[model samples]
Target chain A: MPKIVAFACEHSAYEAATAALERKTGTAVSGENPRFPIVEVEILKVPCTGRVEVIDILKALEGGAGIVVLLGCFEEACHYLTGNVRAKKRVGYVRRIIQDIGLEENRVQFFSLAPDMDARFSGIIEELSKQVVNMGPGPVTRIRDQTTKEQAQAAQAR
Target chain B: MIVAEQKPVAEILRMIEGYRKILVVGCGTCVTVCMAGGEKEAGILASLIRMAWAREGRLGPLIDVSETTVERQCEWEFLQEISEKVAASDAVLSMGCGAGVQAMARMFEGKVILPALNTKFIGMPERQGLWTELCAGCGDCVLDRTGGICPIARCSKSLLNGPCGGSQNGKCEVSKDIDCAWQLIFDRMKSLGRLEALGAMLPPKDWSKNRDGGPRKVVREDMLL
Candidate 1:
């Protein structure tokens, strides 16, 4: 199972992402089934991507997600004038931070799309999913396994 | 406002390696304006250090990082307010300018004082998002002529007489991106019709006033210890 998380803003990006999922598969567009492969892809709808704190992104990675992608409204098209720009800057900051902490920088990415651009939106998901497949599970999962093994050995010694 | 940049996360983490209880102090005046040693920055640094320590699998000592913001660290009174918190902590991380850090060190003589940011220079805010260093604190001001471009402030060599022939097309020969300060002065003076002032030639700057013998000190008779 590919564990992916999509952080979408309340504006155009969320709507466009939903529409793209419906368009990708021939499923009926409904609230129940948004229709994207890996239905477990947790979709976090934020008020604005700019409001998504860097700590939130780090905590999500710590919680075990192979890939985390932030989707924002197109440049200059955001409901807030420079909200998307701020989001981009924060994402850039987070990318550097993740790399410094020993995580692959490519695991985190940002995509911009207008409310009606379904093709571009779908392409982004497909590309991100392919990258996740190549990278495999995140480091948190491996660290957990190692800790579990160490605990078991210590328990046996006792 | 005094500008400073946060020390790298790894370096900060290494500095506080053994300390379990830490106190993070921030100066709200100069450092706050620079977005370096402010309340927000201090909180972020403390959080990052905490996380890094947790990853080391040591279940580290009782780590207590608290924040206290002071108006100006140059005064001993503002620093004295945090005497209780300073006494309780195993180590103190100061996120103020160099002056503030030194003041903290002086106030708490035997306590370990670590600087969390590097002090850069005296500069003015260029715009909302930009700050450019404008003064080297050479203990002199010669902005009367040459339209406010201090040959001492902006020039690489701090030349006051004239361009050193290393300036080409208004750019310094040492580095391409830098605009020769003398060239800028020349243009500004020409525009103001004050080019005649350039012929006067400034004498060598007096060095006594700036870091001459040792660390600079100022005394006020009315505000004595």
Candidate 2:
């Protein structure tokens, strides 16, 4: 299955995502279908979404993640004052870089929500899953694997 | 400090499309302070370049990117440390100002040094994330007479004598956002009790001291000797 890397803020999205995960796990423990098993997401907790750098987003895609998401607090409600604001600007900047690189601008995404919005978190995951299903396998992984194979082949020939 | 902004990624990508290996060299001085070309920015640019090419898959050979920074690219000693990196790559993507890029180009002599920044101006930060120009570097001093306000840089017309008729509501004729330099000069001088100094009409500015001459240089005989 394709992978999705979501950088979630501990202050907001992380807690909400945790709640959603716990709810899903409980339903599965009761012998019912685990709905979230379909969407493969690796949630990395960050102190603040503002701490997310532009290079990190590119690195995630380079590391085989199908898509990258930045989840943070709402506008004017960031615990560190302007962390969310800065995160938004960084998202826009990264989007421009990837767009210029000929990739879909939607490859990178940003969202804002409170800590208690578990349902919203679930919706975001479902949306990403649908996106990847339509997009198919990411070209980044194929290109990277091909580059590695070519380098190895050149070494053997040498 | 000198201010600059990064060029669009598309333009930068176009310039390096032919090169198999590229080195992004950043300056640690003015460009870093202005948030245009710094160590972090260099990393961002390198990553973008790498990924862009990797996604291309068949644009040509895979382009590899490396990043490094110098204390000051304008000086020779600082640039010496990156000699090995410079030799390893076909093109050097300089994230420094005009002088830094030219210095690298001269030092390497054979390699291509591409500029990644558009040098903006000599200015100071007016507020958080905001920088405003304060000097024109006209090779002449006029601040002592205008109560320290620079009419050459602040005024749209670079007026030497009095406020022009275009000044309205304490703003310049260029735009409402720009404050009138004469208004600021008058207010500052009035508060300093130096308004009487304006009674004398000043002579016309000497254009020879400005950029009228081709490429001016300074020499220090005592230090050189």
Candidate 2 docking band: medium
Give one digit per residue, the lDDT tens place, for model 1 in B49-90.
Answer: 554444454332355666778877768999999999999998
Runs off by more than 4 Å, candidate 1: A1-6, A16-44, A53-68, A116-158, B59-61, B64-69, B127-129, B220-225
lDDT of 1 at A74: 80
Give lDDT tens digits, candidate 2, residues A92-140: 9888877887777777899998998877887877787778767644556
DockQ list for all candidates: 0.19, 0.58
Model 2 reaches an interface RMSD of: 2.2
Superposed model 2: Cα runs more than 4 Å off: A25-39, A136-139, A145-158, B58-62
lDDT score for candidate 2 against the true structure: 0.84
Provide TM-scores for the models: 0.77, 0.89
Error of 1 at B41 (Å): 2.3
Candidate 1 residue pairs that clash: none
Clashing pairs in 2: none
